[model samples]
Target chain A: MNLMLPDSGLLFWMTIIFAVVFFILAKFGFPVITGMVEKRTKRIDDAIGAAREAETRLRSLAQDQERIIAEAQAEHGRILKEAAEEREKMIVAAQEQARAEAGKILEEAREKIQEEKEAALRDIRREVAVLSVAIAEKVVRKELSTAEGQKEMVDRIFDELS
Target chain B: MRKMLVIFIALLTFMAHPVFASGSSEGEVDVAEMIFGHIGDSYGWHITEWNGHHVTIPLPCIVHSSTGWHVFMSSKIEHGHEYEGLFLAEDGRYADKIVEIGPDGSQVRPFDISITKNVASLMFGSALLLIIVLSCARWYRKHDALEKAPGGFAGLMEMMIMMVHDDLIKDSVGPDHRKYAPYLLTAFFFIFLNNLLGIVPFFPGGANLTGNIAVTMVLALFTFFAVNLFANKHYWKEIFWPDGPIFLKCPIPILQVIEILGMFTKPFSLMVRLFANIMAGHAMILGLVSVIFVAARIGPVIGGSMTLITMVFGVFMDCLELLVAFIQAYVFTMLSAVFIGLSRQGGHEEATHDN
Candidate 1:
C-alpha cells in the first residue's frame, strides 16, 4: 500500500497516541510486574540476613563454653592446694606430742636412781662406827690381868674421874 | 502578540526569498538543467526531437515566465530520470532538483506532492509507532494464550519485544525495567524507522528524521518529561541541594544552576549524535556520486573507469549506511533508558551516605 506521508496532521495524532499508550501502560501494566520483582528481592535479602545472624550466635556460644571450662579448672586447682596445706599441719602437731611424752619418762627414771644412792651411803657409815667401838673394849681387858701395877694406875684414873 | 510578530517576520523572509515565491514553474528550471547535463538526446517529456541532448522550453511558457528563465534539459541522462524534480528543503532553506536514468532506458522522476523531507520522515516515524503499539496491544490480548500459539506478524513482534525485555530493559536499567519498557520500546522503533527511511535511495523514504535536530530535540523532550514525572523526590534533592558535607549543603547558587542545566544537555547530546551520523552518511554518498560526473568532464576513457569505480564505491558505502542506521537507533534508545533509570533510583543511599 502506498502510504501518505504524515504532515502536521499526522504528527498531532502521533503525539496523542504516544501520550495515551504510555499513560495506560504506566498506570496498570508496570506496577504489577514491578511489585512482584521487589517482593522476590526482599525475600532473598531476609533469608541471607537470618543465616548471618545464626552464624554469629553460634560463634558467641562456642566462645562462652570455652570460658566456663577454664573457670571450672581454676576452681579445681585451688581446692587441691587447700587440702595439701591442711594435711601438712596435722602431721606437724602429731610429731610435737610424741616428743613431749618421751622427755617426761626420761626425767622420772633419773630421780629414782638419785634416791637409792642416798640410802646406800647411810648404811655404810653406821657399820664403820660399830666396829671401832668393839676393838677398844678388848684392848682394856688384857691390860688389867697382866700386872698389879696396872691395877693401881686404874684406881688413880677412877678417883680422877669421880 | 509576540508569536504573531515572529510569524510575520518568518512570512516576510519566505516571500523575500526568491525560491519559494517562484512557484513550481521557476523551481523546474534546476530540474531541467540537472537532466540535460546528465542525459544526452534520447528521451523527451513533450517535445519529440532533441538537439544534442537538450530541450528548450518554449518562450513565454509558464515554466519560463514564472521561473524568469528558459530551461534546456537532456534526455539520455547516465543515472536515471525517474528521480528528478524540485523539493522544499526540510527547514525551508535550500532548493534541490536531481534526475537519474536507469539502465533499462527508464527514467525516475522525483515528483511527489505530499513527500516533502519533513513529511516523509514523519510518516516513517508513525509507521514505527504503529508497529510497536499495535504489536504490544496484540501481545497483551493474547497474554493467556498457549505458549505454542500461531505465529506470523505477532511472532515477529514477539522477537523484538523479547529483545527489548531482555537486552535493553533488563540488562541496562535493571529490574524496574518493566515499568519503562513501553517508552524504551517506542523510542527504539521510532528511531529505527526514521533512520532506515533516511537511507532509502529516493523520495518520501529518504529524509534522515533522526539526523534532523528538531526531531531529536522532541524525542529528548519526551525523555525529559518521563524522567521528571516519574522521578522520586530523592532524584531532585540530589541535583538541587545534594546531601554532602555541610559546605556542599550550603550550595553555591551557580553550581545548582549548572546541575540543572546538565539534565537538558544530556538529551541534547543524544539528538546531535544521531543527527550527525545520518547526515554524514548521506553527504558521503552524494559526494561519491558527484565524482563520476566530475571525472567524465575530463575525457571519455578516464570518465568511464572513474564512473565505474565511484559507483561501486558508493554502493559499498550505502551498505555500511544500513548498519549505521540500526546502531544509531539502538544507541538513542539505550541512552534514554539509562537516563530514566538514573532518575527513578531509590533514595536509600542518598539518605544513609549523605551522597
Candidate 2:
C-alpha cells in the first residue's frame, strides 16, 4: 500500500470539516473570552483610581481641619490680650480720680482752720477795751469827793487844751 | 484471561500453518507488510479476529468517473469480489485502489471519493473538537460576568487558549495579533486534539489522521493563505527586491529568488514536519510489537520472554509517543505563527523607526 498518497475522498472531507470548524470558532468563541478579560482589567483600574482620589480628598480635609483649629487659637489669643489691656486702662483711670478727690479734701480742711484762728483773736480784743472803761469810771468818782484835788485837776486840763 | 490465551493459541496455530505449508524456509508473516498495513489507510475499520473470522466495519465507497457516479458499500469489493465494474485492484500500478474494468477489460482509475478509514477518524476527531470548544464557549458566555475566574473544563480550555493567544500569537504576530488569534487558536487545538486521539488504540482514535499528508497539507495551506492574504505591499517589495546596495543586486539577483522560494518552503516544511514525525512515531510502535511475532518463529520460550520485554519497551515508547504528540502539535502551531508574523512585519518598519 502507498501510505504517502493522498486519497481524494478523505481530502475533500477534511477540507470541508476543517473550514466549518475554523469559521465557527472564529465567529463565536474568541470574542466572548477576550471581551471578558478586557472588562475585568478595566474594572480593576477604575477601582484603583477611585481609591487614590478618595485618599487625596481625605488628606485635604485633614489639612482644612488643622487650619480651622489654628485660626480659632489665634482669635482666642487676641481676645485675651484685649481684655488685659482694657483692665489696665480701667485701673489707671480709677487711680487718677482717687488722687484728685484726696487733693480737694486737703484744701478744704486748711481753709476752715485759718477762719477759726481769726475769730479767736477778735474776741480777745473786745474783752480788753471793756475792762479799761470800767476802771476809769471808778477813779473819777473818788476825785470829785475831794474838792481841792478836783480844782488842781481842772487847771491841768485847761493847759493841755491850749 | 482464558479467552485471551485461547485467542493467542489460535493466532499461533493460524500463523504456524503457513510455515508448515511453505516447508519452513523463511518466516511466514512478512514483517514489512504487516507494519505498512497497520500504518496505511484502509477502506474498512479492523475490529478484531474471532474464531478465524476477520471482523471489520466496512465504509461507503463513492466514486465519480466518465460514465457517472458510482456509490456502494466497501463490503461489495471484499474478498476479491467485483461489483458494478468496480473492484479493489490487487496488482500492477493501481494496486490497493478501487478500479473499473473498461470495455476492453483494461483497468481504468475512477475518481475515488470514498469515506475511508482516515476520513471516518477525521470526522470523529472533528466532532470531538467541536463539542469541547463550543461547550467551553457557551459556558464562558453564561457565567462570563459573574465568574471572575474560569472553572472546570472552561478553565482548562481558557488557559490553553490564552497561552496560544498571548504566548504564541501575540509574541510572534505582535500588535495586530488580535485579528489572527482565532485562526491560530483553532489550528493549535485542532492539531493537538487529533494528535492525542491518534494515540488511543481503539475505536474513534486509531486512524492516523495527522500522519496523513493530505491532512497536514490542508492545515499548512491555511497558514499559507493567512500569511499571504493579509500581507502588505512592503512584504512583496522585501521579497522581490530587498533593501541592499545596487552592486549586490547586479550578481544574478540570487537573493531575490531564494527569498521567493522561502515563502513556499516555509509551509512545505510545516506540512512535512508534522506528517513525518507522527508517521514515524506510529511506525516505531508497530515495529516494536512485530518483534514478538518475529521471535515466535524461533520457539515459544524465546517468544514468551520477547513478548514480556516488548511489552515493557512498548509501554515506554507509548509514553514517549504521547510526549511527541504534544511536541509535534506545538511545533506546527508555533512555526505557523512565526511565518505569519514575519509576513506582518512589512508595513511596521517605518512605524517602529518613528517610535
DockQ top scorer:
2
On residues B2-22, what C-alpha lDDT tens digit does candidate 1 reach at each position? 844543443333222222212
Top-lDDT structure, candidate number: 2
DockQ of 1: 0.02
TM-score of candidate 2 to 2 decimals? 0.75
| Superposed model 1: Cα runs more than 4 Å off | A1-162, B1-116, B128-144, B149-153, B243-251, B348-355
CAPRI band for model 1: incorrect
lDDT of 1 at B240: 83
lDDT of 2 by residue, B1-355 (tens): 9944543543344333223322323447576765565567788876555555556799998898667898888888998898887888888867778898877888888998789888888888888888888888788678755437678878888788877777888899877888888888888888899987777765667678899898998999999999999987678888888888766666788778778898899999999999899989888877777777778888999999997898777777777877888888888888988888888886787657767
Residue B267 Cα positional deviation in candidate 2, in Å, after optimal superposition: 0.4
Instruction: Give DockQ: model 2.
Output: 0.37
Q: List the residue pairs that clash in candidate 2.
A: none
In candidate 2, what are the lDDT values of residues A23-113, reduced to their tens digit?
9888887756755665766787888899999999999999999999999999999999999999899889889988888888888877777
